[model samples]
Target: MPALASHRKPRSRTRTNSPAVGLTTAAIASVSLLSAQSATADPKPSIDEVQKKVDDLYRQAGSATQEYNRAKESTAKQRRTVDRILDDVAKRTDSLNESRRALGSYAAAQYRTGAVTPTAALLFADSPQAYFEQSQLMDRLTEQQRSTITEFEAEQAAAAKQRAQATKSLESLTASQQSLRTSKQTVQTKLAEARELLSQLTAEEKARLAELERKREEEARRKAEARAKAEAEAEAERQRQEREQQEQSGSGTGAGSDTGSGTGTGTGTAGGAYAAKAEKVLSFARAQIGKPYVWGATGPSSFDCSGLTQAAWKAAGVDLPRTTWDQVKAGQSVATADLLPGDLVFFYDDISHVGIYIGDGKMIHAPKPGANVREESIYYMPIYGSIRPA
Candidate 1:
C-alpha cells in the first residue's frame, strides 16, 4: 500500500522563487557583515577627550569671536568715516558746481563785453620782471575784472583741494572695505569650522559636554566667592595692622591702607564709591548680566568680552577702543596687585579676552558662546595685564 501511495502523483508543492532564496541569503550575509564591522569598530571618544576637544574648539571660537568683534568694530568705524567723507565729498561737489557756475557767469559776462584779450599775459607770467609789471598793471585794471579773476582763482584753488581730499578719502574707504571683507571671511571660516567640529559628536556626547561646562562654570563661581571672601578678610587684616601701626608710632599716616578711591580691588574697599563715570560703567556691565555672549555683538542685549567692556565704558562717556589689542592700550597699565574695580583686565598671551574688574577677585565678563554674562574669578584664566580706563 505504501509503494502504491508513493507512486501516485504527490500533491504539487508550492514553488519558491529562486531569486527570493538568493535575496534572503544576501540579506543575512549583509547583516552579519555589518554586525562584525560594528563589533570591530573603534571605540567612541571618552568624555575627557570630548571635553578637551570641546574646550579647544571653544577657545578657538573665542579667538575667532574676538577677531570678528575687532573686524565689526573696524567696519563700523570705517563706515562712519566713509559717511563723513561722502558727505564732505557731496558738499565739495556742490561747491565745485557753484564755482563752475560762477566761472560760467564770468565767462558769459566777458563774452557780452567783447571778451578780454591777452590783457595781461606778460604781467601774469612767472618771472620776477613779470611779477613787478603785474603789480604795476594791477592799478590800471577794472574793479570788475579784478573781482572776477580773484573769485575764479579762489574757487579753482578750493575745487582743487576738495578733489584731492575726496580722492584720498575714496582710497581710505576702499582700504577699509577690503579690511571689512577680510574680517567677515575670517569670521565665517572659523565659525564654520567650529560648527563642523561640534557636529562630529553624537547627541549623548553633546549633552555630556554641556553638563561638563556647567560644572566647570559652577566651580569657577565657587572659587570666585571664596577668593572674594579671602580678599575681604585680607583687607580687614590690613586695616587692623595699619591702625595698630598708627597707634604704636602715633603717626597720622594710615599705612597699609588704600587710596580709598572705591576702585581699589582685591580685599581693599571694593563696592566703595567708584568714580561717577566708573559707577556708570559698572552699572551698565551689571545690567548686562545674563545676556548671551555673541562674538561680534556690541549690544543692548549681547556682547563679546571686549564688546562688553567697551560698551560699558562708552556708556560711561569714555570711548574705549574696539578690540582687545587696542583696548589693552587704552589707559594706564596697573599691576595686578593694584587692580581696581572697573579696570580692564586682559587675558591670554594674545590679549584676546577682557573683563571688568568688580573688586575682590571677581570680574564681570561675557565668557563665551553658550554662556551668558556672569561674574567669575579673574584668576579663572591666566591674566596678561590690567588697565585703568576712568
Candidate 2:
C-alpha cells in the first residue's frame, strides 16, 4: 500500500490504475520517489505537467476516500441485517425445543400406559389387521419423536451457518475499511513530505500568493454584499405591500404596522415586558449582515439560521438552544400573525431552518448556500410557523 501525505509532488507519465482509496497513498509515495529521482540529475518534467499531475491526484484522493467510507457503511449494514435475521431464527428454535421436550414427556406417559395394559391391549386386538395397525401406529409415534429432533437440529445447523457467514462478512468489511484507511493515510503522509521538500520558495513568491488570495476574498465579499442589498430592497417592498392592506382603522402601536393614519401608528413593544431586552435583540439581529452561514454555527462571527436566532435572543436577556430542532420547541406557541419582531420563524417540515420574524411579512435569515445574512420576503421560503422564547 502506498503511503499518502497531504504534501506530495505529482506523478506524471505514469498510469497506476489505482483503486480510488488506495491510489492516493501510492501517488504520494511515487511523488517522493520522483523527487529523489530529480536529485539524481534526471531530466525533470515540465512545470505544467507536474502541476496537473498533483491536481489530478488531489481530486482522485478525495473521491476515493468518500467511496471507501460509503462502501464500508454499506457492507457493515448488510452484515447487521443478516445477523438480525439469524438471531430471530435462533429464538424460534429455542421456543420449539421447549415444546419438543413437553411432547416427549407426553409420549413417555403413553408408552408407560401401553406397557401396563399390554395383556388387555392384546386381548382387545380382535384381528390380525388390527394388531398390525396398532404396531404401525406405535412405530409412527416413535418416528414423530425422531422427526422433531431432526427438525430442531436442522434449524440450529442453518442458524449456525448463517451466523458464520455474517461473521465472515463483517470481518471482511472491517479489514477492507482498515486497508483503505491505511492507504489513504499513507498517501497523505507522502504528499505532505513531498510538499515540505519543495516548500522552499522566495519571499516574492509568498507575497504574490498572499496578494492574490486577498483579491479573491475582496471580490467574493463584494458579490455577497450586492446580493444582500438587492434582497433587502425586495424585502422592504414586500413588507410595504403586506402591511399596507392590514392597517386597522385605528392603527395599532405594533412596530411592524405602517404609521399611515392622520394620527400615530407604529410598532409597539409589549406592555410590562422586557422592553430593553427586545430592543437589544432586534439590534443584534439586524447588525449581523454578511456573516458566513455555517451549519450549526453559533459564534461571534459565523452563524446558521438557528444560530443567529439563538445568539440574538441570548443578547436580549433570553436563552435559546443551539440547533433549529431544539429552538422550535423552546418557546410558547403564538398565532400565525401574532409573532413579534423577536419571535422565531420555523421553515420546512423537518424544522431544520429558522429565522427571526421582522414583522410586516418580512424576516431576516442566513438563507440558503451562497447567501449571507439578509432580509427577505417570508414567502421566499416555506414557512412552518412561529416560536416565542419561553
Candidate 3:
C-alpha cells in the first residue's frame, strides 16, 4: 500500500499562494537587495570630510552643552524654589498643629467645666463652623475661644494650600531635573561621536586635518585683520572730518567751540571708561589661556564658551548670565564691524557659543571639548552678533 501511494502522483497536490509565504519571500528578496546596495555603497569619507564631520559634531556638542547649562541653571533655581516652598509649608504645618493644640485645650477645659458634653466639645474642636451653627453652643463659647477656632481654620486652609503648592513645585523640579539629565546625555553622546571619529584617523590624516584647520584659521585671521584695519581707518577719517568741521566753525565764530569741546570730552571720557574695563576683561581672559575647555564650568581652571566669557566679564565687574542665549541679551547689541575689545562675540544662529573680544578682530574663548582656552579670529565661526556687556 505504501508503494502504491508513493507512485500515485502524490494525490495531485495543489499549490496555494499563502499570504505568509508570499510575505516571507518578499522580505527575503528585499533584504538581499539591501545587502547588494550596501555592498556597493560609498567608500570611506576623505580626510576633509572627516574633519568637517568632526567639526560639525563638536558644534552639535557645543549646542548640547549650552542646553545642559540652561537646564542646570533652571534645575538649580527650581530646587531653590522647592526648598523655600518646603520651608514655608513646614512653618504653616507647625502653625496648624499649634492651632489644633489650642482647640484641644479649649475642648478639654469645656469638658472639665461641664459647660458642654465631651462629644459636643469634640465637635467644636473638629468643625468650628458646624459647632457655631448651633446657637446654644455658639452663645456659650467665649470670644477668645471663637478667635482660636477662626485662627485654627485659617491655619488649616493655609497649610493645605501650601502643601498643594509644594507638590506642584516638586513636580516641576522633577521635570527640570529630567531635562538636565537628558541634555547632559546629549552633550556626552555628541562629544563621544566626535572623539570616535577623530580616533579612527591615522597620524598622517590627523596631521593633515590639523594643517587644514590652521590654514582655515589663518585665512580667517587675515580677513579679520583687514576688517579691523579698515574700521580703524574709517574711524580716523570720521574723527578727522569732525576736527576739520570744528576748526572751520571756530575760524568763522568761536560761539560753538565750548559745545564741541564738551561733546568731544564726553565721548573721550566714555571711551576711556569702556577701554579700561575692556583691558581688565581681556587681561583676565588672557590669564586663562591654555585652560581646558570644560562644559558648564565657570572657573579659574576650566570653562565652556559662555563660561569663559562670563568669568572674564565678571572680572571686569560686569555680571553676565550663565548661558550664551541670555548673555547675548545681557547688553546692547552691536554690529560685527563695531565689535571692540570686551564685546561679547556670539556665534551661530542660536548663539550657543561666546567669546570675549580682545580687539584686532581676535577673541579669547574656551573653544570646545578636547581643546583649550585660546585666542582665535572672530571670523573663526559665523558671527551672529556682538554685545557690549559694560
Candidate 4:
C-alpha cells in the first residue's frame, strides 16, 4: 500500500511540471514577436531615393563612355598618322639607297681612273650644305649630279624626321589605347553596380519606379511643348515688328528676322531654304528614331549619342569627328537662341553627349544603353553648347 502511494505522488508531480512547461513556451513566443517588431522598425530608402541613385549611376556610365570615345578617336588618328609617316619613310629610304648606289659607282670609276672625282670629294665633305660652300667639287660636278646629291640629302633628312614622328605617334597611340581600356572598365563597373542595385528590388517596386519615370518624362514633355510654343510666338512677334519697322523706314531689307518656317514636327524636312542642308540632317536623324543605343557603335542600326549626331551630319555631306569632344568643334558655334535644325547640341558640363536639333526645342539622340534613339526636350539635360554642322 505504501509503494502504491509513492507512484501516485510521482504522477501528481508530472501534472504540475506540464503547466510550468506551457508557461515557458508562451514566454518564448512573446520574445520572438518582440524581435520581429524590432526588425520592422528599421528605416529603408524611399523608392524615389533609389531611382535617383540608379539615374546617377547611369549618368556616370555615360561620362565614362565619352572618355572611351575620346580615347578611341585619339588612337585612330595617331594610327593613321603613324601609317602615313611609315609610308613616307619607306619611299624616302628607297630614294636614299638609290642615291648612295649612284654615288658608290661614281667613286669606283674615279678609283679606277687614278683621279678622285668631285662626287667622291663631295662625299668626304663635312656636310652637304658645307660641301657646296667649301669644296671645288661643286664647280667640277655636272648640275645633274649636284642636284642628285642635294635631293638625296633632303630625302634623308625628311626620312629621319618622319621616323621620329612615327615613334612619337606610336607612343601617343599606346597611351590612348590604355586610356580607352581604363574608360571601358570604369563604365562596366558603374553599370554592374547599377544592375546589382536594380536586381534587389521586388517586381512591384520596379513597376512603381517605372511609373515614376513615366510621370517625370511626361512632365518634361509638357514643359518642352510649352517652351516651344512660347519660342514660336516670340519669333513671330519679332518678325512682325521687324516688317513693320522696315515699312516705316521705307526699307524693303529683311534683316534680323527668324527665317525658319513653322517650328515643324521634328520629323519633317521643311524648315527653309537656308536650312536645306540642316533639313537633310534632321531627316536622317528622324529615320533612326527607334534604333538601339550602343557604346562605341556608329552604324545604320545602332549608335551612341555622338555617333548618332556624327552619322546624321555625314548623311547631310558634312563630316563630323567621331567623339563628342571633337565633334563639338566641327562647326560654327551658335547661341541657344540661334539653334537651328542641323545644330549639334551638346549636353552635360563635360560635353559627353550630343544630339541633332530637330526644331521645336527638341533634339534626337541615342540617349543611353537599354534605351532607343528618340527625340527629347533639349532641356532634358543641361546644355553645354551648340554648333551648326552644315
Candidate 5:
C-alpha cells in the first residue's frame, strides 16, 4: 500500500509538470516569433524623410488654419446677422404689445358699454373668421375697433415670424461657433504632430535637416529665376513680333502711331498706379519679415500665410477676404508668367497658402509655424495660381 501511494504521487507530479513544460515551450515559440518580427521591422526614417514628413504636417496645418479662418469669419458675420435679427424681434415684440393693448382697450370699451364681451363673442362664434365676419360681432363694432383687431392679428403674425428668424439665426451662429472650434482643434493637432516629429530628432540631425532645407530652397530659387528669365524673354519676343507686324503693315505711322502712343501712355499710367500700390503692399510685407508665423493671426506681431497677404493688401487700401479660398476669388486671375509685385500668389492644389508677390519669382509670406514671415521663391511649393488683387 505504501508503494502504491508513492507511485500515485509520482504520477500526479508528472501530470502537473507536463502542462508546465508545454506552456513554457509555447511561450518560447511566441518569443521567437516576436523576435523575428522585431528583426524584420522597418528601419528608422532618415533625416530627409523626417523633414518631408514635417513639411507635409505643416502643410496640413496650414490647410486647417485656413479652415479656421473661414469659420471665424463666418461666425463674425453670423453674429452680426443674429444681432440684427434679435433687434428686429425686439421691435416687433414692442409693436405686438401695442397691438395687444389696443385690442384689450377695444374689448374693455365693448364690455363697459353693455355690448357683447369680445371673449364671450369669440367663444360662442364657430371660428375666428366667423367672429370677425361683418355680419357677426364685427357689425357691432365701429370701424376703428374693427381695424384694431385686424392690426393685432397682423402684428402677432409678424412678431412670430421675427421670432422664428431670430431662432434660426441663433442656431446658425451656434453651428458656426462649433465649426470654428473644430477647425481650431484640427490646426492645433496638426501643428503638435509636426512639432513632435521635429522634437524626436537629435540636435545633429536637426542641423542636417536644416542644411537639406537650405539646399532645397536654393534649388527652388534657381528654378524660379530660370522660369522668370524664360518668361521675360518670351514676353519680349512677343512684343518684338507685334512691332514687326505693325511696321510691315504701315500701321506704325501717322494715326496708327498716335493710337499706339495713346495706348502706351494709358498702359504706362495704369502700370504706374499698380506699381504704387504694389510698393505699399511690399513695404507692409517686408515690415513683417521677422514676425512669427501664427496659425490664425492677422496682426502687427504674427501672421499666417493668408493673414499676411490680407494684412499687406489691407495696408495698400485693398480689402482681401480672410481665407485663402475666398481671397483667390477676390481678384483678377493672373497667370504665373504675368505675376507682378503685390499679386497674391496662392500655393497648393487646395489653395491653403498665399504670399504677396515681390517680383523676380519671389514672394513675401508667413511660411509656417516654427518659421517667420520672409521672402522665398514662389517655386518653393506647388503654385496654384496668382491673383491681381488691385
Candidate 6:
C-alpha cells in the first residue's frame, strides 16, 4: 500500500504518510463471502501486460519524433532553395548593370565620330575650331548616353525588388526550419521521459512478474476450459433437478421441491461458459494499467474503488451496476480459498471496493488515488468475499 501511495496519491480515503489500516470485521466479511462461493485462490495478472503497454508508449513517442525530424528537414531544404533563388537575382542584377555601361560607351563613341555621319563633318569643317566644336558635341553626346543608361537601369530595377522578395522568403523558410527543429526537440524530450520511466522498473521484478503473468494466463485458460465443461454439466444438472422438483410439486408431495426448482432454474447457466466470460471481464480490467485512481469515481477515465472494477467488467460486455454493493449481488458465493480469476473480490462491510481476481493471491483493481491500476495482494486489503458471476 505504501508503494502504491508513492505513485498516485489516493486523496479521498487515503493520504500521504497514512499508516496501514486495521483488518477488522469488515475485512473478515469480505473473505467469508469469497469462501462461500468458490474454492480457489485469487491469482495475479502476468507481468507481460505491463511490459507491453510500456513498450507501446515508447514506440509511439519514437514514431512521433521521427515525423518531427522529417518535417524539420523539409523546412531546411526549402530554405536552401530560397537562398539559391536570391543568388540568381543578385547575378542577374549585376549583369544588367554591366549591359547598361556598355551601351553608354557605344553611344559616346558614335557621338565623337560624328563625321556628320562623321564623314560629312570632315568635309564641312573649315578649321581646327570646327574640329574642337565637334569634340565638345561628342562630350555632350556622352552625357545623353549616360542619361539613357540611367533610364534603362530604372526600368530594370525589378531585379532589386525580386531579390528583396526572395530574401524575405528565405528568412521565412529559415524561421520555419527553426520552429520544426524545436518541435522535434520537444518530442525527443517526451521519448526520453518515457524511456526513463520504464527503466525505473527492476529487471528481476519484471521477470518474476512475467512468470506470474504466464502462469496466471495459463490458469485462466484452463479455468475457462473447465468452466465450459462445468457449465454443460451444471445446465444438465439444473434441468434434471428442475424436472424432479416440478414432478414433486405437481404431485403436491413436497414444498421443498418448489424451492429446488427455483434454485435450479436460476442457476441453470451456472458454470456454463462462465470462465470465458470472466476472462473477458478480467481482460478489460487489465487494460487500464496507467489510469490514475480517483476518489469515488468509476469511469473509463479516472477510477475510484468499485468504479474501476465495475467499469472494467462493463468493458468486457458484462453489465455491473455502479457501486460495490451492486456488484456483490452478481455471482455465486464462494469461499475465499476457492476464489480464482473471474471471481469478484469484495472489501469492507459497506463493500466500498472490489476487484476482479485473476489467480494467485493478487487481484486487479483501481486501489486508490496516486496508484495506477495494478494487482495487489489479497491480504493487502480487508477482503470480504468472492462472487462468481457466470
Deviation from native of the Cα of residue 125 in model 1, angstroms: 15
Q: Give Cα distance to truth, residue 389, candidate 2, Å.
A: 23
After superposition, the stretches of candidate 2 with alpha carbons farther than 4 Å from their true spots are: 1-61, 75-147, 150-168, 171-179, 182-194, 197-200, 247-390
Compared with the true structure, all predictions reach lDDT values of: 0.73, 0.59, 0.80, 0.79, 0.80, 0.61
What TM-score should be assigned to candidate 6? 0.32
> Ten residues in a row with the worst lDDT in model 6?
259-268
Candidate 2, residue 179: the lDDT equals 60
Candidate 2 CA-lDDT value: 0.59
Q: How many backbone overlaps does candidate 3 show? A: 0
Off by over 4 Å in 1: 1-50, 76-141, 211-215, 218-226, 245-276
> Among all windows of ten consecutive residues in candidate 1, which has the lowest summed lDDT?
114-123
Q: Per-residue alpha-carbon lDDT of model 5 for 227-338, expressed as tens digits?
A: 6677566555656666788889888644233222211112233366677787888888899999999899999899988888889989989998899999999998988876
- Model 4 TM-score, all chains together: 0.71
Cα distance off (Å), candidate 6, residue 111: 99
Query: Alpha-carbon error at 376 in model 2, in Å?
Result: 20
Can you write out model 3's per-residue Cα lDDT over 47-153, one digit (the tens) per residue? 88998898788888888988899899989999999999999988888887777677666656655656666545555444665655453466677898889878878
TM-score of each: 0.70, 0.37, 0.81, 0.71, 0.79, 0.32
lDDT of model 2, residue 209:
49
Q: Best TM-score goes to which candidate?
A: 3
- For residues 1-390, write the lDDT of model 6, one tens digit per residue: 454436766678645453334446557888898886656664433456555555454434433433454455567677777878778787777776675555535544555643344434433455323443555643554565545545555546767677777878877787777776775666566556656655666897667756865775676556545544554565567666766876877854543343322111233234546655666777788888778875445567877656777676676677765556656888689876566567788875545567777655567877643467887656554567879765
* Candidate 4 Cα errors over 4 Å, as ranges: 1-45, 112-154, 235-260, 264-273, 329-339
Query: In the order shown, what is each candidate's alpha-carbon RMSD?
Result: 9.5, 19.7, 7.8, 9.5, 5.8, 28.2
Residue range 72-154, candidate 4, lDDT tens digits = 88888888988988888888888888987776554454345536665666577665656555644456667777787788788
- Point out the worst 10-residue segment of candidate 4 by lDDT: 262-271
